[model samples]
Each structure stands twice: as structure tokens, then as C-alpha cells.
Target: MKSSAITCNNGSFFNVFDEGMSLVCDEDLQALAIAVIQTEMKAVAKLADRIDRQFVQACHLLLDCKGRVVVTGMGKSGHIAGKIAATLASTGTPAFFVHPGEASHGDLGMITRQDVVLALSNSGETEEILTILPIIKRLGVPLIAMTGNAESALAKLASVHIDVAVEQEACPLGLAPTSSTTAALVMGDALAVSLLQSKGFTRDDFALSHPGGSLGKRLLLQVSDIMHRDAEVPMVDDSVLVSKALLEMTGKKMGMTAVVDEGRRVMGIFTDGDLRRMLEKNLDVHATRVATVMTRPCTVIASDILAAEAMQIMEAKKINALLVVDENRHLLGALNMHDLLRAGIV
Candidate 1:
């Protein structure tokens, strides 16, 4: 046993505990926090080492699942189950949590034979979970059990047993679920991300699932969605003077104008930068045809391509404006850096 320090300030005391049965003073609080973190880390480390065929088998089961991954638990385990379900759902797997106690009261209707059941119970002897085990078996749904005690009832009834037994709880009393719950959460994430990879899930898939988020905007937003269209786009015919092209650019405030043919096909692009370079040469903007000053073979993007892809093209080419074109290279619209900026995509 070690001595516990009681720090008295203004006759008030703060009593804190340390790892060796010693007391933590204000000065020792950091060390106590480090111990708590290390204790939980060890649980995760042990889980990492024990990941064997059972973990791999769980991944395979989830990968091949025809429907949702139905996770259920009781008490503290139930909280972990709900979090695991949320993580899996957001990461590419279709999953949700079911309350085991509620299952006995008719919530079992939420599950089906096409789904896989992931039951979490540290002791593997949770009564609510055990009571519904027969019905889960009856429904012919595949059972995956996560428990500390492999020999316990839930494990015995499982089609695949995932033993998440931690050496000890981070809780000093060893009663509250701490290290065990952390280990379980990590294991669920491992399963979710691994299964995501096995399914060849991509950022595009994730973006679709998270459509209301910024990632969705980046991956799903198209050039056509943000481009200035119709008469809003600045354009001029090749026969127009460079000075007239500049008028279109100034009026539209796009810093550039597309030089087109009679059919509105993109012939070239004249930009403010071209004006600066031509000004140095003293070329008469009023006398030169827009085609003579425009940059030929300007970088263009398909209206249907992802806005993110268009941004990449812009950055790679070091150009700010892009002509949105059809398959025939006819100019449909115009997009500039300002457009992407206003759309909050820059």
C-alpha cells in the first residue's frame, strides 16, 4: 500500500487516487489520466492480438450479408451496440441496433432471416439476449456473438463466436464496463472498415450515403449545377473584335469570354490575361479579331462531370475559367473560380 496525498488549499481538500494504491494530488492528476488511458489501450492491444480466424470469419459473414447487420445488447452493452450500429451504418454497411429486452416484447419483428444478428454481452449470459436466442435461431438468421465468456450461453448458441474478453476493466472496482466496452467498440469498427474494403466501397459511395454533408456536395455536385447558363454566359463570335469580347467579359464579370462559331461551338477562349499580354505588345484590341487574341484549345469540362473533377482539372491546368461543353464540344455554359467559391466548393 502507498500513501494517498490530500492537498489542502484554503482548508479545502481534493482527494484523488493513483495506480499503486497511492493518492493523487493536483500535481499527480496527469499521471492518473495517463494510467487510465494506458489501461484502456492495453485492452485494445489485447484485442488486436486475439484477432484470429473468428474475427476474419465475422468480416466474411458481414461482407456476404444479404441485408442489414442487426446488432443487439443489454445495459452498457446495449449502448456499445447502438454506437457500433451507427458506425457501421455510416461507414458503408447497412446496420442498426435492436434492444434485446424489447425483442421479447415483439420488437423481434424488426429482424429477418435475410439479416445477420450481432449479439453483445460481456458475460454471454444476459437473460434478455438469451431469451431471444431461440427466436433468432428459429428465424434462421445467422448469429454472431461478441462476449467475454466464450463458454457462456450466448456464445454457445452463436454461429460465429467473437471472444472480446479483456484482461481487466479500467474501472478500479472492476464492476463498471470500461476497458471491455472500448475493446468491443474497436472490434466493431475493425469489422465495419474491413467489410467496407471487401465490398470495394469508395468515397463516392460514402458521399451518396452522406448526401447532406460537405463530402456529398463535393462528389455529387456537377458542373451544370453551378455553371452560368444561357445568356448569362459571356460569348462572342470569332469575327467579333477583341474589344467586343472584353465588353462581354466585363458585363458578365467572368474574367473571360468564349469565342464561338455560328453554331455556338466553343472555338477558343479570350481571357483578361490575354488582354494584359496583348496590351504589352500594343496590339489594337479594337482592330484585332477575337479569334486572333483568344487562346486556342482551351481547357473544357463536360457538364455532367463531377465538380470536384472539374476543380482538379482547373488546378492542374492553372486556369480559373472552364467552358462547360457537350459531347460535341458545343459550349453549354461557363464556370469560373468565383462560381466554385460561391458554391462553397473552393
Candidate 2:
């Protein structure tokens, strides 16, 4: 024993108990996870091909719905159903989530005669969901069941059954709801998006529902609503000196001024950038007329156009400010990029 020599590698662990944890790092384990994902993706793809008359019928039912779509489910199915309901509600269709458990405990009052109940359950026999079925039926509301089992108790009771059955579970044990839940979620999205397209839901309509988001700012903000009117608008007569135009730009804090003729029509625009270019040429600001230094045929737009459209115009013309004018070329207002940003139009 005293003469024995031993050497160990740096990569090998000393604790025997810790070696078992290597299963988490095993390549076979990783391959299994990848296989599960690929299988689920294929399932989703096959489901896409199955969108036949049943899918169209579902869309039609939702399109004709005069009231909100009441979505309900149990367990993991409930989570996916909640997201589907939100997507439908935000995209032209009125909808809300109703937990089946709560529905049995007096939340059933939320459902109306005009409403359609879309129930979700992988097994289609969730006790909580089944308990609310009679109440939904008594309320004279139709049910749309989404489940894997076509012969499920819930499916048998539904007016229209949309099968979201998957070939198998992605879970190795086949206990966890994986592929089945994914199929149901994707199917729900398909329904919501199809209804959204059928309704021809415009960006403005979406904006109205999401005014707190950036898209709402882009679509809802109008030129007249955000432009600087009256004293804030920088303007100078054509005969005014270039120095006076610069002063107007400074005082108005717009970095530009409208050069107007005697008829009150916008003849040209003078900007801080233009003033810098003029100075590089050693041009006499004191003697030169504002009209001589201004950029003619300035970019103009109607005050009623959306601010998002205004941003596009500014980008297209390679300019920062716009002269808001009426049909007669009468200066009505003016605004720059900064104004749009302040109004959350950016």
C-alpha cells in the first residue's frame, strides 16, 4: 500500500452520488428533447392541413355571434383557453375567460343568451367543465368543444366539435400534457386569426382597443390633433430678412419657419439646416430676403391625415418638419418629428 501510486483525471467527479446527475448532461437525453419538439411541430403542421369545412363553420359561428365568446377549460387546458379568449377579444371578436370551477359556483351568470361557450379539455371529461355544461345549456347558450377525444362526454354535448387530437404526447411518460396542449393552443389561434381576417379588422380598429400600445399612437394620432397651431407655428413674410426667419424659428422652437407670400400661401420653408448651408456660402443673412434662402415647394400635408402617414411622408421626403395646409395652400398648422414623438406618434 505504501508503494502504490494513483492518478485521477480532472474531468472525473470525486463523489459517486454526483455521477448520477450526468443523466441531465447526457447526449441521449438532449436528443430525446429534440425529438419531442420535432414530433410536436409535425403534429401542428398536420393539423394545419386539416382545416376543412369544420374550421370554416367554426369561423362562421363566431362571426355571426352577436355577443362575446365565453371560453372555459380545466387545468392546463384552461391556461391555453384563456390566451385564446384574449386573442379573440383583442382582434375584433368580443370574448372572455370563465373558469369552469367558478362557473359552477355562481359565475355562470356572466354568460348571456347571445353568448357562445367554447370549452377546452384534453380528456373532454373534466369534472369541473362537465358540471357547468347543464348550466350553459339551461342558459340557451351553444357549446363549441375542443378536445382530442371525439367520443368524449363534452364533445357529445357540444353543438359543434372541433377536434384538436394529437397523434401522441411529447412527454416520455405520456402523462404530462405536451403535444395535446400544443395542438389545442394552435387550433385556438387558428380560430382567432381566421375570425380576425373574416371581419376585416383594420389597424385603426386594433388601435382603438390598444390605445396604450405604440401601434395605437401611430394610427390614432392625427396631424391636426398633434400639430402646433397659432402662435407656436413659425412663420415669416417673403420680404422679411433671413435673420428674421432665423429668429422666428428660434422663438417658435421648431427649427423651421414657413415663408408666406402676401396671399398667405406658403411660398417656401426656411430651416436651421438650410441656414447653416447658407452661412457656409458666406451669404448675407441681414440683407437676403427670407424667400431667397427658403426651400420652395415645401412638403405639405392635410391636417386630417394620421400621424403614422406623416412619419412615412417625412421619411420619403427626407425632411423633419411638415407644413400643414388647407386645400387653398393656406397655412393651417406646422409640426416636426419632435411633436410626433411628444404625442406618442413615433
Candidate 3:
């Protein structure tokens, strides 16, 4: 095996394998990885300069779109376009990816005059994308082009062209779509986020689009949505024996019971923790009233509050359960740590 020393940008020397080299050391591999990252970083950083008037026009076109933003690209650009479309849609912009090839097929119907077209082609000369340009123009929809070459046909024909041209590819061979694709993706994010802010998109709005995941559960799930309600809520009269309150807690499996008055207004709460303390004092459950040992002014939440907020309150208070009540102190429901966990909010 033979290797030669090469000077890195940091003025440090590292080994590079010779012609017959069949294996490389960790240091050489790390150096190559670092170079790739540095190249991509520079490419992304250059995009900051491209966020000029044309970028704003592209965003305005997308914002004013009455229908969905139709994104199209070819090959690797298509994959990035799909991701960009998803991000835009999830961020409150109605958008979907249409492959350039498919758009030339019957899928071109997906693009309407009300929609805005966003086309991605690194060389600005993807044959598939260029094939659909005439039809897109005939539809009279705004076309936003992302390409590397400003003089390319796609850029010249576009309503607005945003340059995603990179100085070089991260690939040593310089033929692969490495840094260029990243620049396009970042530029897409810039457009999507700008549109999101312009539309005043909120977390609740995002939750509507993502209702099936844990994120939806955190943002959309409320205290009332998962609380034990009606007959499921464990409750006992303040006049009841601690032993009877224990039975209510056990039957409901909530580990706690709200002690209410004759009017069904909550006075306090008794939990398994209280039972442990009662036993330490040798207090007889059957002889003692629940109100005598219950915690006064226990933590309570309203039904309209988010379940995530409830979790925060519970964690901060170091308590495992909360009583849901009306503004008039009327008991409505109950919940515990187990309930949050069951709802995937914990």
C-alpha cells in the first residue's frame, strides 16, 4: 500500500491513497466527507444572495394563486419537487407534485388556469419539463422557474425565475445533482415559509392537515376530548367516608375521586397518595370523612384547554391527575397521567 500527503483548506495534511490503493483509512474518508459538506454549505449560503425581487415575485405568484400550486420537474428534480410540494401543502399552501412526463400525459388536466405552476430543472433544459411549457403558457397561469442557467429557455419563458445556480457540485466528479438540488430545496422552503407567514397560517391550521399523527394529537387534542366524562368520572360526596371514596376511585380506575357537595360542586379531591398518608397516621378509612383528608383547592382545568397544556400543568405541579370543572365549580370530568399516555399526548 502507498499513500501521499495532501494539504487541506485548514493547512493540515492528510493521507490520500495512490493508484493501486484498495483500502482507505478513517482520516482520509473523514477528509473527503468534510470537503463534500463544505462544498454544499457554500452552495446553500450563496442562495441568500438570490432572495431578491424575483424570489418575492415567485412568492407573490404563489400567494395570489386561487387554486393549488402545481409543482413539476424531471428525474432527481422531480423528487425534490414532490418534497417541496408536500412542505408547501403542509404549511397551508394547497400544492401537489405533477411529474413533467405525467403532465405531458392526461395528468396535464391537473393544472388549471386558476393554479400557479412551479417548475424545477437544474440545467433549465430538462426535455420533459420543456415539452409542457407551451401548454402551461396557453393555460395563462403564472410560471415560477427554478433553474441553474439564467439564459436557459425555461428561465426566459417563465413569469419569474429564481436562480438556484451553485458554484459546483458536491460530487467530486461534478456530474451528479448534489449541491444544486439542496439549493433548490432550500429555495423552495424559503418560498413556502414566506407564503405561510403571509397567509397567517397558525399551528391549529397545520394540525388540520396532519390529524393522523402525534403532532395532531398534541395540537388538536383537548382536555375534553380525552377526559373521563359523565358516568366515567369518579366522584364522591364530601360527606362520604374515605373508604367509600376509595371505592369510587377503584371502580373508575382513575386513581382519584373528586369530592363534591350536595350541589355537585367540587370541594376537593382524594387520591391514592392521600390514602398512603392516611395510613401513616393510622387513620381509619371507614371512620373518616373524605373531605377531612382531601386536598383543598386542587388543580382543575377547563374542557377547552389543550391536552398538551394539561400535561405541562401536571408536570409542573408534579401531580398525576386533574379535575375538569365549569366556571361555577361544577365537576364535569377527570383525567390522569394514564389518560394522557393513552391519548398519545404524554
> Best by lDDT, which number?
3
RMSD of 1: 4.4
Could you tell me the lDDT of residue 292 within candidate 2? 80
> Which of candidates 1 and 3 is the stronger one according to TM-score?
3
Task: Write model 3 residue lDDT over 1-346, tens digit each, in one string.
Answer: 5888767666666676777543455566898899999999999999999999999989889988999999999988999999999999999999999989988888999899999999999999999999999999999989999999999999999999999999999998899999999999999999989999999999999999999979999999999999999999999999999999999999999899999999999999999999999999999999999999999989999999999999999999999999999999899999999999999997
C-alpha lDDT of candidate 2 relative to the true structure? 0.88
lDDT (Cα, 0-100) at 250 in candidate 1: 92
- Candidate 3: stretches off by over 4 Å: 1-22
Candidate 3 residue pairs in backbone clash: none
Which candidate would rank higher by lDDT, 2 or 3? 3
Provide the lowest-lDDT 10-residue window in model 1: 1-10
Top-scoring candidate (TM-score): 3
- Over 85-201, each residue of candidate 2 has an lDDT whose tens digit, in order, gives 999999999999999999888999999999999999988999999998988888888789998988999989988888888888899788899999899999999998888888899
